[model samples]
Target: MDATMENKMGLPPPYEPAAPNPAPPPSYFGDNPPPPPGFVAPPVAPRTTVITSATTRPGSTKLGPGPTGTTCATCNKSIVTRVEYVPNNRTHIVSAALCVLAGCCCGCIVPYCMRSCKTANHYCPQCKAFVGSHQPS
Candidate 1:
């Protein structure tokens, strides 16, 4: 191969250094700049709030009827009564069998009709921690 062919297959060309940045413009104001006339600053909302000894912070608590005297072990907050329907593993097999044997009506509708098919999962209202579950006997 020729010198030109060898150069083409060789390493890439050397990189060129970039030009130095131009000097920044001088500051018009020495330090603080005065606000324009009649330009009243927007009123800031007052931060005053009633301090409470309760460990539960505002916006941190869950929205629901909190169960009285029931303390959460996870977040140390009061537990609340919240019913969560979770799919039952045993019922899932039945549902799948019904789906295969019967049409969409029995398969899709039977599971929802059976309320006991799903396990009730109780969670903490504050931190959404899993408190306990109640399975249908």
Candidate 2:
């Protein structure tokens, strides 16, 4: 019936620290580790490159819808290229959209006839070789 005995019985147990967590696997650290034993790395391959000289002939040049002056690769002559208009994807898409909206009227056909909507194909007037094509920007 002692108050000390009752207080002792009501007291909680003393604290004890729990064991520390085990070290995490190396993969979790995200550090670059050494290669495994007896691992043979493959030999590096040499890089190949192609270069065009300006003195010989200029590289690919972007052309416009109008005549462009460029050195032809086929004839190796410096001359103004003649442009020929060809209906490209942009022309077709615009035409299709116009056709859908205008009920297949002359509006859809406008893109096919317009010079702005089509791609310009450049040809060397000397050799008549296809130089390059300019897509509408």
Per-model CA lDDT versus the true structure: 0.65, 0.83
**Per-residue lDDT of 1-137 in model 2, one digit per residue for the tens?**
56677678996555688769977656843677778999999999999999876554433776878899988988888989999999988998998899899886779889988899988889999989988888888
As for candidate 1, its clashing pairs are: none
CA lDDT, candidate 1, residue 40: 88
lDDT of 1 at 15: 62
Candidate 2 local Cα displacement, residue 2, angstroms: 57
RMSD of each: 13.6, 9.5
Residue pairs in collision within model 2: none
- Lowest summed lDDT across 10 adjacent residues in model 1 is found at 59-68
**lDDT of model 2 at position 131:** 88
> Alpha-carbon error at 125 in model 1, in Å?
0.7
| Residue 4's lDDT in candidate 1 | 68
